[model samples]
Target chain A: MRKREPRVILSFPATVDAMSMESYSAAHGVPGRLIPLPTAISAGCGMCWCAPITDREAVERAARDAGLRVSGVHEMML
Target chain B: MIYLDNAATTLHKPPQVIEAVAEAMRSSGNPARGAHGSSLQASRTVYGARAKIAALFHCPRPDHVVFTSNVTEALNTAINGLIRPGDHVITTDLEHNSVLRPLYRLAAERDVALDFVPADRRGNLDYAMFSQLMRPNTRAIVCTHASNLTGNLVDLRQVSAAARAGGALLIVDAAQTAGCLPIDMEALGIDVLCFTGHKGLMGPQGTGGLCVRAGVEIAPLKVGGTGVQSYSPTQPAEYPTRLEAGTLNAHGIAGLSAAVDYLNEIGIPAIHEKETALMRRFLRGVRDIPGVTVYGDFSGDRAAIVALNIRDYDSGEVSDALAQDYGIATRPGAHCAPRMHRALGTEQQGAVRFSFSWYNTEAETDQAIRAVRELAEE
Candidate 1:
């Protein structure tokens, strides 16, 4: 099996806000997949976008340009 | 059978709406939770519905629209979220139970000050009084765009202006007018709009929502799994998601989306013209019935509902006769609008309401009028 690596997850205040980030990222071909908030993360909403830990800066920059209000960002091993 | 209780729900949906619901059920999954094809498809269908609703209501962004099971839930969310303890709110006598009960609950439980601007016996609003009733602490001005019981219309633009002058949020219950009549959210400056898809929107039951303006922030009424953020103790604080929680009625939204598409193709003004014309026909045909009494201002601007009663019969009896003898379905007994009935002095005898829809025909109109006339004669 491939070795599991730690990834970056960005949580938003609302599901729609997270989805907006997903939408913007896809249009710009940024790296991230919206997923159920990782249990390792202590956020309130049910969804967050996960990207390779290396893609943190670009993912966040994309979320910012897209006007998404990220509640928190976490790095955790899957 | 003739269905005249459209104020409750429109029974006949445009064929496309029916197909869309089935199509969604067949292929879609939880939207936004995953990047899988099914999830993306569901997401698109929901977004498409939101976009169409935004266009119809003149909402600036599709994301501002939040889906709920029905308008009642939307109203509850808006009322519960916006009016906190010590907040003052202004509503009206023409409100349905959906608006009234929620405000009433907030008043009792949260220590909110509630005042209702009384309407005239004909269901005409005292628009100027809305300004007079605003307190320094007023947080919301909530009212219905049209009275569900009498089909009387409120000039929402005027109400919006009053709310703005007081720096209060204007929340409109567009349950009866959303898809049937044109609403320009920007022009009207509505802070929150609550609507049901099953009524004039021509969608299936169990689909409705609220549209929030860009700057107005409301607390979430309920919090649960949003299929996104699983870790927070508090609800997510975003426009639609801040308001919408749990699994969305995606299948119903699929129908609602298709329904909005149908409404767009037909045009709201055209639909309004057709429904009200039929109502006027029924009115004119039955106007001479000796024992009959009608409610509502027959002013040009009106909803597709007509409320009335025969002299000797209870509103329920009249409605029962219409349904049993004439095969005409109507709503009777206060319409969950007890305050409006009290205002109209129909407190003891509730009114029978005959509401129309686009699919109804001139033939059905005549039959309803004739039935009322025959009942009057008997």
Candidate 2:
């Protein structure tokens, strides 16, 4: 048996920015996955990136290096 | 104008929805795929939202719910992913363009046969008609849970039972009923449930998804990078990642999650009771008006969407007057369901639609009734 949890999530100002972050992170070998922004954060519907909490810095750096705009970052037990 | 066309997109979202989007934008970082503190928080937020939606739909597994831009995209994903060329699909006349257009396109291009089960004059689906329409080539039956134009709720249980008997998958478009009605995906036997977040869900626009049943494999509509499978060129074969490609609408999801929470806290049954009561009131007021013709069954289970027309008054004219003169906003015309209007014998004239939500008060319905009464007199 195995267990799973979502540790890190990123929010973007615009859908394109979030999309660019996904592209940049993937191209640069960052660890995370794009998901619909969670309800805990908002009741509106949109997408966000989710990953293990530990990979935050590398992914952020990669997003910045790729010229992708970052909105907000959070750590939660999911 | 006083907003009344909620079926198109709900106006005035709950305060929590706006706050959640802002907070996510301000605090959370890239989720799931990231490893930092902010990303971890963001991931948790997304998971929490998924759980909320799963709870809303009574889905056993949140992972089965895959996000999309809107119900159209969700419907497209389910229809295109599941039906191959030469496969048969059974649908209904009450379907919106979202469901009709894609199925039509697939029929023309992919050589699939689409059978439409016609709705009766009252916008009710005849299950017997649906059973007769089934064929060996019928691999799936996609139907809207409610009519967007007339607010007629289809008997999903009957349809699902038919699908089960025929060994076909049942896909339901829950766009109008997801938040306004009580829907249990597992209990309904619905193989795929497509819904939008902006309407009854109380979320902002640009949020929708498909709740796919376990063991059902639908091909990905778009393929790119899923943040996972950095090594694989093709899309990954997982529940959500398999379907979700490219960057998701994080801000929208945050808002949607908040909307779902608001609905949950308020309780869907309560919302349903409130909206339906208002609908009944509105219908009763207009039912006896000499010049007004109301569509759909007033006695059965349905959403709050009401379609009507004043005698000798064009639908668009009434809608425009409702907006310009009375400051009451409503949707006019075919309501993106031309076939539905045609079936109801109102295609040429269309109809003025007043779709209600929890935000609408009894006073608003009274005002709408008065406005219609005035229009009828004119």
Candidate 3:
């Protein structure tokens, strides 16, 4: 079994942005999943991207390469 | 602007809802499926949420609550999983499309027999008629806790009694009533309870689940890797993992947990009292307005939803006017209960709905009253 660890969580300001991140990352082979923004991060609600810590460089590269604006990113155990 | 479309979804969630969701993302990993530290923490967070939901609904076991994408999926899972071919299922006219659409599809595809108990002109169901509809193959009785259109509440005790007597399981769609109304799963004999987090629970959209009582099993609607028993091609046969076959909506659950915590802190009784009071005030203000016809029972049994129409205006027109001119947001048309509207004789011109929530204020109710009165006069 692959060991899983909570990585830095990134939240976009809009639903479309988060969705775009998903599309961009998948096309470029970036590793992450779009999930509803975790509650501990904010009481206000929307979706965000949960990437594995090991894939941080690839995700960031994908975001930059795809010309997607990055949102707030915080490292958490989740 | 006043927001009275809570039946569709609650507008503003509690502050903790956001905080909890963020915290979950920061601190937790995939729950109950791993042995690593982060995974264990994630598992604990999920279990804590399950306990919170169990406490809220008074479920005997926390494991009984299974998460889904939304109430629609939950309803589909329960209805489709339980009813075999040629089985009979009893439902009512007050159901939202989430319940009705899936059952209708099952009836056509799986050959299940479906009987709908007609509601009164005001959208109240007659339990006597429902009792008579029970047949030998009646496997389940599925009904909404409150009508999404009219906000009329069914007598669950009566329905539970009837289902129990007929040897049928009772499924209640608590999308509108879970956080706003008091419900005890064990005491009420509800074998299956479906709830949406976005509505009364005040969480974000895309979060909902079903609470399965002991001895009830719902097949997985979609099969995939549940991060457990990955070697096996078939779905896991555990309580929640059996049905939750995919990457779980951990973020939604995190927000849902916060929403549930907010409700618990304020208390359901207090929230209900606050909302029902607003309902009464709005009812009183709109009842005597000329050309305004209200739907649903005015007797306070319903939740915060109310449907009404201006005498000569189309529901859409009134809704647009309310939004554009009055700055009040209200839902117009069938409200996803087309059959209920048909039963209420409002199918031709669906009524406008004003659904309230705990965050709604007395001043907002007054604003809605003034707006409707102005629209009615015009």
Candidate 4:
């Protein structure tokens, strides 16, 4: 198993929102990749944007500019 | 054969659309169902298509675009999800059965009241009737942007004004006009815009969807397996996920995405101009032909369609003759527009319909005109 580390997870209510976030991030150099919604997070059963904890601010800013339908933001250990 | 029945479904598609579908079949996995590269690729392709459709129709939110199997499914979703029991709805005689049947079922099963804005013998709607048909309990005004049978474009601005004045939602079925015409849902005051990707959009047959306005809420027709809220008994109450359930047609959507790009590159106005020109040419040739009677008003903006009957002959016989004798293809009979046919007073004879697409050439148009002339003479 990999060693545990802190990660910033952004959750969306729908898969389309997460995909939008991914698209916006790719276009604007936001730092994140989509991962399956971590079971620890109770938002929804769809994909969520996961990034390094240090890049949380940048990711949040990108999502705001993109007007993505993000449901929740969480920081957790992986 | 020179295929002219484009309103039914475009017989020719851009090569990019074909290639995109082939590529998706080779590479894509189930979208939003997994985190693997293939699944993500499928997800991205589907999302890309949604964004393209949203932009093309001027839908405010990309996430609000929900994919369905075809215009029939899209219309079903919009009609069934929004209209409630005892709600007063206004449609038009120009609507295809996709709009009529659902509203009919609602009238039968849900106690909904429906009134249709009548069309004249020329297939032109009396736009003033839109407001007159409105009731205090009116929930929506559902109609087509253009008639599939006659090719007459409805005056949506007038319809939108009526809907707004009556405080009712305007749901437009863009089956005949979507990719062939530029539609700004916001500008047109459309609450829900239903479109099929195959006909004017020149995509795979299985692709279509509805674009809902931000604040509009539609109860889903089918609910299960959205891949979100898996444990919840209720469907996720989000824009798209609220309506979309089960696996999506990602491959078809991939093709639709490419088709949109192709349309963008060519520009919609240019395509409309070419198609309208072909339609006018065909009209000029056949309108003066003896024993020929044509349907629809050609004096205003319309789709590239011409419906005509030759010398009291059955429309099926004329269409079959066009195919077997002239090597030309056209649609015949009811066209799922029983009301439109009745309005034109051709309910018994039906009509031979020739619809044009961007892929059709002047030579093909002239050939179709010649075929119709010979058939009328016979």
lDDT tens string, model 4, B113-200?
Answer: 9999999998888889989988899999999999999999998999999999999999999999999999999999999999999999
Question: Which candidate comes out best when scored by TM-score?
Answer: 4
Off by over 4 Å in 2: A1-78
lDDT per residue for candidate 2 within B303-373, as digits (tens), equals 99899999957899999999999999999998999889998999889999999999999899999999999
Give me the displacement of residue B133 in model 1, in angstroms: 1.3
Task: Report RMSD (Å) for each prediction in the order shown.
Answer: 3.2, 9.9, 12.7, 1.0
Task: Single out the weakest 10-residue window by summed lDDT for candidate 1 chain A.
Answer: A38-47
Give each prediction's DockQ, rounded to 2 decimals.
0.38, 0.04, 0.02, 0.68
Interface RMSD of each: 3.5, 12.0, 15.1, 1.9
Model 1: fraction of the reference interface contacts it also forms: 0.57
**Cα error of candidate 1 at position B376, Å:** 1.4
Kindly give the stretch of ten consecutive residues in candidate 1 chain B with the minimal lDDT sum. Answer: B227-236
Clashes of each: 10, 67, 21, 0
Best by DockQ: 4
Count of backbone collisions within predicted model 2: 67
By DockQ, the better pick of 1 and 4 is 4
